[model samples]
Target chain A: MQRDALIGEPMVRLTGVAKRYGGGVIALDTLDLDVMKGEFVALLGPSGSGKTTLLNIIAGMTPPSRGSIHIAGDDMTHLPPSKRNLGMVFQNYALLPHMSVYENVAFPLRVRKLAEKDIVKKVEAVLDLVQLGHAKKRLPRELSGGQQQRVSLARCIVYDPSLILMDEPLGALDKKLREQMQSEIKRLHKTLGTTILYVTHDQEEALSMADRIVLFHQGRIVQQASPADLYFKPRSVFAANFLGASNILSTTAVGDGIAQLKSGETIRIGSGAAVINNEPVMILVRPECLRIERYDETSHLSAANSVPGQIVSSTILGNVTNHHVLIADGHTVMAQELTRRTAHDWVPGEQVKVTWAAADTRALEPDEMDVHS
Target chain B: MKETAASASHSTWITHCANAWAWFGYAFLVLPTLVIIPMSFNSTDELAFPPDSFSLRQYEAFFLKGDWLSSTFLSFKIAIATAVLAVVIGITAAYGLARSSFPGRGAIVLFLLSPMLVPVVVVALGLYLYFATLGFSGSALPIIVGHTLVAIPFVIITASSALRHMERNIESAAMIMGASPFQVFRKVTLPLLRSGIIASALFAFLISFDEVIIAYFVGRAGFSTLPVKMFSTIQWEISPVIAAVATLLTILSTGICILVTIIMDRK
Candidate 1:
């Protein structure tokens, strides 16, 4: 739906951006990025992974040590935050305790000396948008945490800035409220069509809300992609492990397109000229993609690779039961089931045969998957 | 019941000794102050702890004497000006020290607090030599300046600590929303530091108003502040009038303390 008006042009560009803190601590190292107009892009990473550093640099709160930044095609690297004209939401929901919700929302308008009627109208509109219309007369301390967060949102958006910087905006909320606010933020973004740069360490929040996710690791942008693309086609073991659970297995190439498991069982690997014969390789398959049972029941076994293992532990996660199995090679492999029908009732120490379709197994680089296999 | 009471009670001789000591301590402290208030109304020109007759002569002389009245007015001006100056400088510096981090910041903080740590004799000696070099020794200006300098560091420490727990996110949020840096500071930071600033101002005022050591070195004739004049008058003559002035100063300082407590309570 957003492809029509805004997706064609890049609204913000960070070219070779980098930042180094005091005592030679490098937060961001030569990071390059582009955010499309009207897109909600999440800068996702663990703490100290340069996500917040990127947000601060984009907000103009801090200057990059070694790169240029442009906003809507204008060079804004040297401008202060005042000139940047962006709205930001903080994790703490920093509303003024002395001010009523109405006055806090009107703060920006008052600063600009907007006409009193216009200020009133804009503040009312934003308050209604955040669903705090009834509580506008109350002070910040009187509001609940979720209500306070909504007021913070109203205050940030009343001015209608072109960009909104949110640094872990919902991170302080409990799980249920966070999920509710995720929908609220998504709905607001749909209506506003404003460029938003969100930063957070929570991967699920990033995956759920982002039009695109820029994943950072150790001061580097390890990968950037759509959630589905990052999940299914991760380029490295780091990506696979960080995004979700993956069981990587080591195999010995027996022939062209065929591989022998360390257990001496032969299975078909996808044929490619890149697949060198008799070469050692690490094969990655997601936990849920594996179908397993205590005994082999399949008649047509050629379509799938079968491995024999003993269940070490299994956890019942409502709809799915995650089984950790130990292979004959002393490697622990994880398998997940969709329903209780397959293996939820399976106890530890049960002999099991796990199988996956050959096409589902992605061969990761040897060095990247060394830890798993 | 009789046996329980005997068991709970302390030794009779020790209890009596403790009560006697407490009463004696009370008397020792109350003896001087119990005489001054009533003796201020003495009829005689010469003074004693106990007077033969009573009148309001000393009270009348307090206002009628040109030197005392002028000295009180000059002291008021100096104390007020010094308080304002010290609070402004101290609060700004303290806010900076609290909110910002830089190299040698700890040492800088210690240096600012050094005036409070050093002995008053050393401070008085330094003030004496410094004012004498400027050829303004025994003048009211040097004494006021010295007192302001000493009072400022106290204001700075109080305000800086207040600013540290200030939830810096308020300023950041204001900036994010469309307020300029100055607007954020004026509206958010200032209101939050109001209690600290008022406390600092009152404290600085009292510090300078009652100061004696530096004033002794720097105060001169024709411009003697109230405390300096009181000190000199007490040296030349220990009269009931000085005691009356001392009692008034005590009342004024007590009023300031009460005012500070009320303002802080409002916060």
Candidate 2:
């Protein structure tokens, strides 16, 4: 869907960008990235992952200690944030407390020296776009958290900036409001067709909203791909663990597209799985892909892989049920299945067998920390 | 149940005692000042509370007497100039201190606030000697300069807290919205700090208007401030006109304080 929006030259390019503090602490390591025009890219990471620092550098609020930055093919490494012609939405909404909502939205235009009549027209139109037209006279403090966020959105969009940077803009809102704002922002991105670089620590937000997700860990890019690609083909143990819950079984690659788990159980691998001989690897199986059945059952014979385990616990999550199975070598694998009225409920301590297709598993390189452990 | 009731009643009794103590404290601080109002209405030359006859005679002398009105005008002029000068210097210093981190910043702040910690008489004497060395003593300029020095620390304190409490990201947001640094300061920072700057400016004005130590130390015969004139009169004789001047000064300071409070408490 976003392919058409991604055509043309990259809107933002960072070449070997890096940041280091006075105490020799590395906030951001040297990294390169490109963001296409009109494409929404999410820098997704946990805290201290250098996502916010990268956004700040691109916004020209913080200068990179090394490397260069380009915005719309212009070198802007040394330019001040004011000269960048970008807009930013902060987590706290950062609205001018002394100004009314209308004036706050009008601030960028007023700085640009637009005619008063034109400012009024533009401000009203943008306020209406954000569904905040009636709140023109209210101060930011007078508005609810969601309303304040909308006003901030209005303020940033009123200037028609070429790019927008959002630093966890929905972080402070409740879950329902955050979901609503997520779709609202998606609609705005579609309507405006402007590039956006969003920084967030929320995996679900990045998965649902962004055209592409750039996963960061320890000041480096762990993986950069479509949400589905990252989920299905995680390149490392960290990548597999970060995106979602995965049953990672430490294994040693054997010959003939097979790997032996630590418990000495063998599993079939997909034909595309590139496994080096006698190398330590990890097999990632998502919870939703696993099938759980009674241990005595002869079913799932064609599934290509099965592991015997005891049911540790089962949790009902409204639409789906999660069953935690304790396999050999103290490895626990979670299996999720959609709740069905006719399905048998497995209780704790019940022996079960879990099965999955070879195609559903990803063979990944063990992370350095995991290898040491 | 009995113990709980006794404890609740004990807390209520403590609250009533604290309230009465607070009211008594306020009266102790305010009643002596309020007494000047009635004394200013004395009909005779003697200054007295509850005058035998109510009259504006003291006020008449205050407005018509030698150098009384002139000195008041001089005080206003000096105080306004000091307020403007002090606010400009103080807010700039406050912004610099709040926004940047550099070596020796703490020392710089200590130097700026040193005027407040030092005795006013020492500061006045230092300024008096410095100006005498420069051959600039005994002029209205010296008095204005002296008052600004003392008033600047209060302005810095007020403006610094405002800057500290302000949302720092608004400045960055404005910058990314295509506002130049100077434009951001003018359009965003200044307007956001409007109340704090105004309150501090009024504080500067009040400090300069009421300042007698520095004014007397540096004032010329032709440029005597109202407080300095009042100081001289009280030292020389007990005049009823001084009572009227004191009442006016009290009213002016109180009005400015109320204005400052209102500005600070506004949303």
Candidate 3:
């Protein structure tokens, strides 16, 4: 994609970026990216999706095989990391083992050659922001994983660069600490107004914190959208599957915005470019979006995108109960209900009717294969 | 619990036996030097263990005498110079081997470390011939150069072992934080390997200080390290002074070895 001026400011821009390893392995295919100022963008993917590679490219830690990167209207593609002036928080903390927390936080400022008073003040402020000022004199090894991560945060932001790059910075923390840091990061982003490019395999993190998420697979981004758009209107099977658990059903186009399931059941769907009239296509629907009710075969059981299935097994998740239903065609469909009260009556071996609204499903592109839920 | 206690007692007995065996193995290593120190005090000219009589004249003669005292001083200066040169060369070479990937990198590392695997006699012979033509034969400078060459592999091996465990990203992180290459090496990499660098320095010192054949092969009529001096004194005639110097060299080298071991263990 060619670069174009977008509104008033472009915080970061990557044109035709690429990375190749020693063995001629293409780690990142040619890519382009644009991050607007004050935007919090998440590069979300499964493992080896080139998410971190993209972040590294922007951070100036790793040079791209081809093309250029620009931050704050300056081309920094060929520059060394020190000249780029970008802050990065690594997954492993990367704190200097012998330095105390305050020194780690003050490192970037020291590199900037700021005066002692300015450095001390800036460091104390960032430390206070991360709520780690009380432990300023402690070494990194003395801190817990969560506290170490906060120290890393303080270091990355203390110098106040134009941008911040985080590579799974919270992956090592416990769930509670991870959530807490996520919120703290969001609050910090709001206050700093600095552009951010975060990389993670966790889709939930992307959904919870990002202004927009770029979903990557293999070495390419399959989709880019807001969290709600990705959840409610995914245009590709991979995006739908990766964002959440999705069931892909093969279907043949019938007519009037409807398609025939392989079970010979006609299903209604929304209008989209993923399919042409009378063309074979796949529909992606999430488990929670699907509905399973007690079976009543007396009415011929004909309904739009509805199938008669037997309840095979069920599990009660905290917020929802998940049911496994074996369809007449032998496909096991997953159905989740908001409450156990609605699913309690269903017993193993009992028949049930599975259905979903057509608008909730999307036409799945063949190239965009479903991600394993 | 009662059965477990009984099993613990049996295991403790086995551990005690193993500990005794460990002491026995160490005793074999220690006995030779221990015997030599006492034998150095023998009153008679011919050196003998469980001497007929003990005296301090050996140590007195060693300190107040011949080229022996001057040679010991020369050896210390050479060892010190060798240590510094070896550490600087080894650190840079090891960093290249550990950090960079290039054509012939593996071969270069093999070449650098090969000195350790080659026989000291071969190195001594090669250096002796080279020194003769280079106009450095029988000089303390040649001895220092030769010993530094021998000591470099030890420095490289130890430094590389310590450096290999360091994440390459630490350097990158320093770079990202606006550290130049020199600053990153100094502020980040060097600080992390403090003890390892000291240990490597000590190893280099010990390597040169303990060297005998190289010094013997290249020692001029008057120029000699303590080792070469002691060697000639023992061969020319039996003397307690040589034993006194020998005990000092043993103590110094063994002390350095223990120090390096301790530092490496701490790391």
Candidate 4:
């Protein structure tokens, strides 16, 4: 398959889109999003985060309560879904149970009143593209979950729509099948060069498949950036915890570039840290960034902050070992170390030191805890 | 080991007793219909069970009599019209009731199904009084309209149940793929609902065909339906032809019920 080299013009543009249901339940707050042609963007969020609602608005299935939508530079705010010329793949595949696979794939063309010959050719090509050519005569119930999803994909793309919206399309599949379909979808997106807006709650899926990830929280967009950028530098505490596992410690800024932990240890912050003196902040350290060593062996290490703690628990997870250590102030911090053939195993209640460079840690403003008094 | 064997034998005996009771229940329900079938074939003119001889004379009489045949034909026509009207109105009502949320949705559903909950004679009397004021008591329109009113509830029940089972996203998928609302209904919703609609139409036809109380009150002059005709005949005289008609109706209604059961099971 030949790839489209040039990134095309803007494919979808949403300005101040809002969706308020009856009784004043806000499914989507005022939000703006843009997708360049051929770009694969993933809406990543938990349930009730409005990612699915956002997708529905973009597909024109649900009218936005307020704001405007432009598709391919044409204002489509009031247009019905049929006028938008977009394809959507639902989570359950939603294959028409009464129709044969061939008819299901030919439905869009038939609705458009295309020539019969052209419909057959296009349907056949797309079915072959999804590798379901041999199953054309079978009904949806006769196929496996993965095959059903592929047929759904084939049906959506048969008309060569300018954009495709998929709402957790691989959610129903098992792990191995989900991974296979993810790669298959990515390959198809590359070859077809059609922009796609995917919605999923799985952070790993978004990280692996999307060109950019838009993180949503409670009906608002928290952050939108490339996967690597979001992973390495999350703008908010929610983004940091949601994207990956993080060990957060409550600390108070005591100096120009240092913070005092509750354990009374002063640690120098990295230049990249976003905090000021005398302000309460949360220090975030990735589990894998923390190294476990003996308390006495850390003296030779320079330019690294060390915390003395006791190993409370250790779990071996195939390629790495995760250890939970309790520090002086009764806070538990997690440290993950790669499992090598000759790696030493630390027993419970053994004294240990956790060390990491200042560059590996981040100090940011603390989030308001929503605790009930 | 002894206790297990003893309990197993006890359970087997219980199963045999249960099976015997089930067979007795079925016989109690169906034995009357079986008697009518044999009486329809009796060589004698009077109604009797276990006839000594058999003949098709009553079947021939049922087909050859002008009043009987015409009344049968009229009933079929009214039933077919009622079926079409009920299905058309019922589908839209079911769609609205199933897909949308409003303040009085539950109350609206209860009102639509009120005809079924009320006694059939009460509904029949109400229709008679209402149509009499309009000077339509003696016309076929009253019977057809009354039958449609009763049949609409069944159609709504069947269609709404089917709608509940359907995945709501299929319609949305069709719409997103550039199908207009009408096209989505035609190509997606209606096709998926074909069996349900057909079954409901069959129910409407059967309900109209067999309904006698409303037919008795509304049907007058020359517009009496088959059931009304049969009722009047049985009132003043005894005929084996009525037996034949009953047998035929029994078979038809049974076949339709079986078909509905099969369709429901398939889904």
Candidate 5:
């Protein structure tokens, strides 16, 4: 939420980081990253995408095969985890089973040989911060899953580490509890002013909670940008598809700011340096950006990219209706429309027109798309 | 409804069969021990199960004999040393095997557990020959060493199982919380493994206390263990006093086993 206050020195920096297991499994490629002081960054990716490996590298749990890591202006590439002075929250909470909540939170301070009074005060403060003050005497197994996670969080913050790394910390929780913890973590970050690096496969969580998102695919970082920038201007097809629902169409550049879809329909787009005449390109349009109208109604037309298609299927998803339309070349383009009381229900096999503003469409270089199937 | 009722009756019959088999098994195993208990109280000097009269005469003989008391003390000293040595080596080996991966890990594990797999008689003979060559066959040293070797596997087994049950990330979490390696082991790993360590130590003690073949081969004159003494006594003369010692050994082992079971269940 404090997006304007991100201008500061780099708290953590990774240069040309890579990791390769003995079995030739490439967990991370040459990667460079920087985290500003007090910034909340999310590493968003699918499983096996190396987000966890990157987090572990920063935590000094796993050393990078090649490259150096600098944290708070110190070279820490070979430092052990104990000397890194970073906090981590595992997906399973990883609370000490034999210790009470209070002892679990006080473990870090005790390891530092802090004074007894200071340790007690810090433990109490963190427990209160997480709203677990009443349950400090309870064992980890005696608490609920969410409460155990809160205890893990409290333990992480009690020592006041400069950075906290979370690896899908909310993955084990249900939707409601996950959302609640997300806000709780965000509140903690705001109040503590510690830099955070979060790793998760959930796009919505990253979008809602992160100031910047670094998207990974197949051990490589695809793009790193602000949440709004990532959603609106993805640099590659993977980023476009991973961020949200996107309708992609193969097109060829015909003129300035104009491209012709395979269906022989010309559509205007915001041209970029990559757009050249007679070159093949891929156009990405968000499902929400495409508007569907009955084919017979053409009088209220505006200067926009439009295509005529036949509705293949329509799904009503409470408050929004998704229409899948097949164009002349048999390419399917999806359009999402908000449901209204007076709106017409367009059933399957109905002829319709899909339209969107030129600014809403993005043209990606054809080679940038990684065909998954 | 009829099918459901028929299936329920069928399951009940199977349960009844299983229960009958279990009771028979228990009785078969326990009948010998029960006979020994009665014979331990025999008034006559003969080793008969159905005694003509019951008395504590055999127990009195066991406690009064100088040879029996000295052998018992020697066995206690050797078993205690074996247990301590076994636990020290076993805990370190188990931790290494559980935490690290290196070349020949599987082979090393098999080697550590090879004593349990080999026939005890073979191991006893091998140990006897080796100790004879080392001039240690007549002393308590060879017996203690052999017992320690045999007990190490059990300790490793119990300790390794406990280590496996622990979540590895707990150690990583401790490390990330700024705990040194020694601190992590002492504060996190050791406390979590308390019940397991204690249980394994008890097992080692019992194994060393009850071992017969190795002790028989390695025992020297004036240093025979309790089992060796009993064996010699039975070969020369069938003493009823052996029954009393057997009953006492049974009680000690059973008490230890129950204590281990309770500790494991608590965890």
Candidate 6:
């Protein structure tokens, strides 16, 4: 998915949006975001990061206090949700409990005053698309969680809105079902080619499902890019820490693309990584990038940096084994290894060396420690 | 182990005693009302339990005698009016109090429910004095107004509870799916709340039908409700017809209560 390929009017646009509650609590600050046509953009963040609020504003359920909303080049700030010509799926799969699946799916068309024959045709097609055609006569409560979610998806797409807003629509399901629904939603998006603005706090869900991931923290977007870019080239400490497991080591820039850690270990920083003069910056090294070697073994691989440490703890997580190595007082770097590649399980208190390539380390200004942490 | 066994047996005995006490309380509350059914069919003019030769004469008197039919009609009309009025006011107030917050919301809810907490005698006396001073005495409108005040609290409680349990996102889902606010209320909110609203209406009807204190105080001679007429009859004479009327009222109330219970259970 190339940003340059999405060359048209944005499906949804927000210019300088802000939301302030009573007693001067800011839920969102001067946010400018453009969701391109037919793009699957995810708003990902922790709880209370204004991602849900932004979704509500786009859905027209909540009015932004300061900014204008435009959908498909039409001003929609003053319009209600019904007039926005958008579809939304809620976290709880907010299907009408009193209506059967057929009636629930027909609700949008009925409200639109579509012809009855056409409505039946479209609804049946959508139900079959979501593989819920057999459950049409059943009420929402009679269906399982995944089935109800499918009905909600059917209802949302039956009307064929230009943009679909999903607010953690798979959050209520178990892990297996959630993953199944994720692929189901991605398939729907590909089939329909409708722009989607998905709000989720699950980083893996966003990373796996979205074309673009917009990271939010404290009422503002910290960074927005492709999933790989966000994971590999994050601009801020918060962005790096929020997207994945990161070992942040405090370092002082020694000019050029080099920084020395507080423990006197010098590490090469990736080119184009931002470095501030005479100020402390943080080096973000992902756990997967670190390779653990016994202290006595000669380095066989070419890597830019090596740090001495002893294994303090290790976690076996099915496919991967995570070893936490303490290189200095209160500074531990996590190294992840594939379980099959390990000759034997490394015991705690074993001496080891953690190595990484220079390109894997991102130099970032030590700003914005995680509020949640 | 022996001490534990002894304590378990003691708790079992306490449970049995509690069940017996509950049954006794139920009998004490219901036996007096049960006595009126047989007396309603008494062949003799005197009101007696275990009637001396059961007959329908008391029921006939209740149906065919002085001012009884008209008073019953008046009571039905007032109860219907109260039910309708209370439902309208109560559902609106419940929605407002549930959805939005502003200064004095708690105070408003307390004031709306104050009628149920205040003594009936005090409320009746206050309305009587207020109506007397305003030259508004002796009208069906006053009785309807008084009954609505008594019924509104029940309506609000039932509707608010239903509103509380309802997922607010269901309404938002409708709104985002191209339904207007009015359509959302009509198609989503109202249909989902059908059983609850029906239960509330039934409660209001029953409350207004059985109300005696306010009807006695606010009603005039010509516009007297059924309970008001029954009260005056009991004061003046021990008529067996009063038993028949009591039996009829009891049956109507019990049937309505069963209906309400069924409706609420469905919700």
All candidates: CA RMSD in angstroms? 5.5, 2.8, 3.5, 3.6, 2.6, 2.5
Candidate 6 off by > 4 Å: A1-5, A271-273, A313-315, A328-330, A341-347, A369-373, B1-15, B133-139
Query: B-chain TM-score, every candidate?
Result: 0.83, 0.95, 0.88, 0.92, 0.95, 0.95
The true-versus-predicted C-alpha distance at residue B114 of model 6, in Å, is 2.1
Model 2, span A1-373: residue lDDT tens? 3444567888898999999989998889889898898889999999999999999999988889899999999999999888888899999999888889999999999889999999999999999999999999999999999999999998888888888999999999999999999999999999999799999999999999998999988888877888998888887888888998888888889976788877787888763347988987678899998999788888654746788899999999999999999987579999999998888889899988888888887788666642222
| Candidate 4 C-alpha lDDT tens digits along B1-267 | 999999999999999999999999999999988889989999898998788789998999999865999999999999999999999999999998888889999999999998999999999999889888888744589999999999999999999989999999988888888889999988889988888999999999999999999999878789889999999999988998989999999998999899988987887
Cα lDDT tens digits for candidate 4, A151-240: 999998898887899999999999999999999999999999878999999999999999889999888888788898788777667888
For candidate 1, list the clashing residue pairs, or say none: B138-B218, B138-B219, B138-B220, B139-B218
In model 6, how large is the Cα lDDT of residue B217? 91
TM-score of candidate 6's A chain against the true A chain: 0.95
Local accuracy of candidate 6 as per-residue lDDT tens digits, B63-131: 898889999999999999999999999998998899888999999999999999999999899888887
Q: How well is each residue in A1-373 modelled by candidate 3, as lDDT tens digits?
A: 1113335567988888888888988888887778888889999999998888888888777778898999999999888889988888888899988799999888888777899999888888989999997999999989999899889888888877788999999998889989999999999999988788899899899999998888888887777778887787776767777888878777888776677777787777764544577888878778987787768743332343677889998888788888889886678879888875544567999988887776666776765353331
Residue B169 in candidate 4 has what lDDT?
91
Comparing 1 and 3 by TM-score, which wins?
3
DockQ of every predicted complex: 0.62, 0.77, 0.75, 0.83, 0.88, 0.88
Recovered native contacts in candidate 6, as a fraction?
0.89
Considering lDDT, which of the candidate structures 4 and 5 is the better prediction for this target? 5
> In angstroms, how far off is A3's CA in candidate 5?
11
- Give the distance in Å from residue B120's predicted Cα in candidate 1 to where it truly belongs: 2.8
Interface RMSD of 6: 0.5
For every model shown, what is its TM-score relative to the native structure? 0.87, 0.94, 0.93, 0.93, 0.95, 0.95
TM-score computed on alpha carbons, candidate 3 = 0.93
lDDT of 4 at A70: 95
Question: What is the full ranking by TM-score, best candidate first?
Answer: 5, 6, 2, 4, 3, 1
